[model samples]
Target: MGEPVARIMVVDDNEMNIRVLEALLSGRGYTVSTAHDGEEALEKIQEEIPDLMLLDAMMPRVDGFAVLKKLKENPKTRLIPVVMLTALSDLDSNVKAVELGADDFLTKPFNKALLLARVRSLLHVKFLLDELESVDEIIAMTARIVEAKDEYTEGHVERVTAFALGLGQAAGLNEWSMRNLRRGALLHDLGKIAVPDDVLNKPGKLDKEEWDHILRHPEVGASILKGLKSLASVVDIVLHHHEKLDGSGYPDGLKGDEITIESRIMAIADIYDALTTKRSYKEGMSKETALRILQEEGQEGKLDERLVNIFSQLVERGEFESLGDRIPNLFNIPPPPPR
Candidate 1:
């Protein structure tokens, strides 16, 4: 079968401008939709999201800048490539549009060839991004299925992602680091899939052999992700999140600064969630008790002192949003293969 036709939305107040662009795009075998203003475009978008959007920088109410800002803020429509099409060719307008997440900028009376090229390029990128999203969904769904196997640990992945994200933010991680932290936290236990169901769902404390199987999970999970170059940093988190600062922790026995701060943050988050969440084998610890254990570990060099301190503060301040409820946007940053 041939490639699917790309749907492109043209948001322009001027009827003539919309007609001209629509005709050009349709002649090239592209699907076209037109909206007179940003408000109408946004409404239509909620119903049927287009693959790409060509927006006029200036319109009546809800102009291109406003539209772009709203779209980027939303995880659902954020990846839709937006090309600014308008007469305002000034540096400031172009800069503002790009800053607001416009994918490309083109002035009115734009060359038909240049406009088509940009559209084609952005559409190609959007296709690749869709594929990447599919991969993320598969991994996330697999993790959820694994979690579902153990009825007691429902919502564990999401809660850990939220806790890690909060800690990552409090630790002053950049956009890139925070993105990795989110994925790592969500997929941290993916290795558990290899373990037998009987072992994973066992209610009683594990025998030495069972405990050994559990200890291998970090390395198993890391090996699962190591080949994907895009997830190199995330691989570190999966492999080392179980490691302690005192070298008593898992697989490779990494210690001190040898464990990256990203891994360190995941360690604390994972421990805290495991401590507070009730399991078949043990009752959940109280918030105060959990916090005290974390602090004691930090002071005793079982976890990073600074990050534990920051996380404790966040928990006390209730400063972060609860991302577990918004499972769709839990990994909202849609990371492309990092450089």
Candidate 2:
């Protein structure tokens, strides 16, 4: 198929500036959206995310820097390529814009050819990133299908995703890390598809043979997508989520700090959901009880103390539930098919 016509947004307070950018982009058959100020740009962005953005460096109230900062901070809008258009040619201005996550910077009265070239370059990069996200979506759908093989763990993937993201955000994880965390949470159990139903759903503790089958999932899941460079962060979380700080847990005996923050966060989320979720043979535990257990695990060095502490505070303050409601489930994995 031919490349999809890219959607471009131009955010500038000046009507004249907006018109020039709109005319230029629309003339090239690109879909264009415009906002007069940072606040308007942000609001419009929520309505429809553009593939690329052209942002003015200065404006009233909400300036370009503020808008750039906001966009870069959000995982949803963070990946949209942004070009900073400014009148200031000073080195500091350029540095500040780059620091704020501007994909490209151009001084005003910019050469039309140069601007279009940069726009094309960034758009190409964005297209590649979108393909990666598309791959992630396919895997997420596969993970949901895997989840469907068991009746006892309804909504497990979604719950783990929400909890992991809450912990990630509470721990001040940046936009990129948060994105990978969500992907890892959903696909963390993709390897479970390899386990037999009888073994997966057994009511009692497993025999050594059954237990060994369960242990291969992390590596299996990791290997499934190890080829995707974009998902490298995700692979780490999937592969090491079961590993412990003290080298007791897992397919690999990864020691402390050997595991990444995203992996650590996934491990905590996975354990918490398993503890609190109802199963065929056991009722779900209370939130209070679950929190206490997590805390004990944290104190024992099984989990990251800072993250566990943060998660406990979020759960206790009633902040945790809303996280599930507010977090965007990108890729929009489809529901299970009819029986």
Candidate 3:
């Protein structure tokens, strides 16, 4: 089958330019829409999200750059590819359009063939991104189910997910990497289900053998979740969250870069929450104390430095205040450090 016809919007104040774009794009079998000016284009955009926008740089009231900024700012319209069509072929204009998130650029005397090619390329990219987003949503849904099973850790997934996301973002993780970190954070402790309730909720400190059994949860959880096709990526995270950077942690004793960044971020978020939240055995540590422990212990190379720092910053910024409430206000936690 032939490629799908792209929906293209041609935005130009000049009637001649709009006519040229409509005619040229329509000749190539694209479904074309024309807008006389930026204001009209914005209204048309509100009606239908086109696959590609061929925008004129100069327009009254709202210029191309202004329109592009608005489109990029709105989550609903941000993903639509925009190609700025302008008479100003200067480097400054080209750079400005790109900085404002224009996907492509066309000079006033644009080549019809080049225009078609650019539109096809941008649309293809958008399609791939949309598919990836769908996959991410599916993964997130599955993680949420696992998180819901344990009420104490119910909101644990989201809080740790947010902390991991913040850490990953601060460390310059790519979009795919950040999403994986989120999935890992949600599913990291899934193996705890394998441990007997007596052990999982013990009110006293664990003995050596009990601690050994507890430490095996990561591998056990990894094994259980790995069999499922949807959770394949997260299985690795579950298995490695307990693995320390110094090779002192967990089932396999894997260390450092052997652990993926997703696993590393999950480690910090997991450990920090574990410290600051009540378990059956002990009262939760205060946020100030938890932050200090992470900095001191994380410096030993057990956790990612950047992730620990980001967690500290988020705590300083009050990202986890509501987290303590998720499990319960059961513990009258002490006040956190000054916001």
Q: Tell me the spans in candidate 1 whose CA falls farther than 4 Å from its real position.
A: 1-3, 37-48, 58-78, 86-101, 150-152, 317-339
Q: Which stretches of candidate 2 lie over 4 Å from their true place?
A: 7-28, 31-115, 321-339
Predicted candidate 1 versus true structure: per-residue lDDT over 1-339, tens digit per residue:
655899999999999999999999999999999999999999999999999999999999899999999999897888899999869668899999989989999997899999999999899988977777776777677678767766667888888888898888878998888878878888888888777778888887889998888788888989988898767878888988889999999878898989998899999989988999888778999877998999999999999889989998998886544554576676444654433
For each candidate, what is the lDDT? 0.86, 0.86, 0.78
Between 2 and 3, whose TM-score is larger?
A: 2
C-alpha positional error of residue 98 in candidate 3 after TM-score superposition, expressed in Å: 5.8
> How well is each residue in 181-243 modelled by candidate 3, as lDDT tens digits?
666776677777667666666777889888877788888888887777755777888898877
lDDT of 3 at 332: 19
Q: Give TM-scores for every candidate, taking all chains together and pairing residue i with residue i.
A: 0.83, 0.73, 0.67
Q: Residue 285 lDDT in model 1?
A: 95
User: What digit string (tens of lDDT, one per residue) describes model 2 on residues 111-132?
Assistant: 9899999999999988877776
Models sorted by TM-score, best on top:
1, 2, 3
Q: Cα miss at 250, model 1 (Å)?
A: 1.4
Best by TM-score: 1
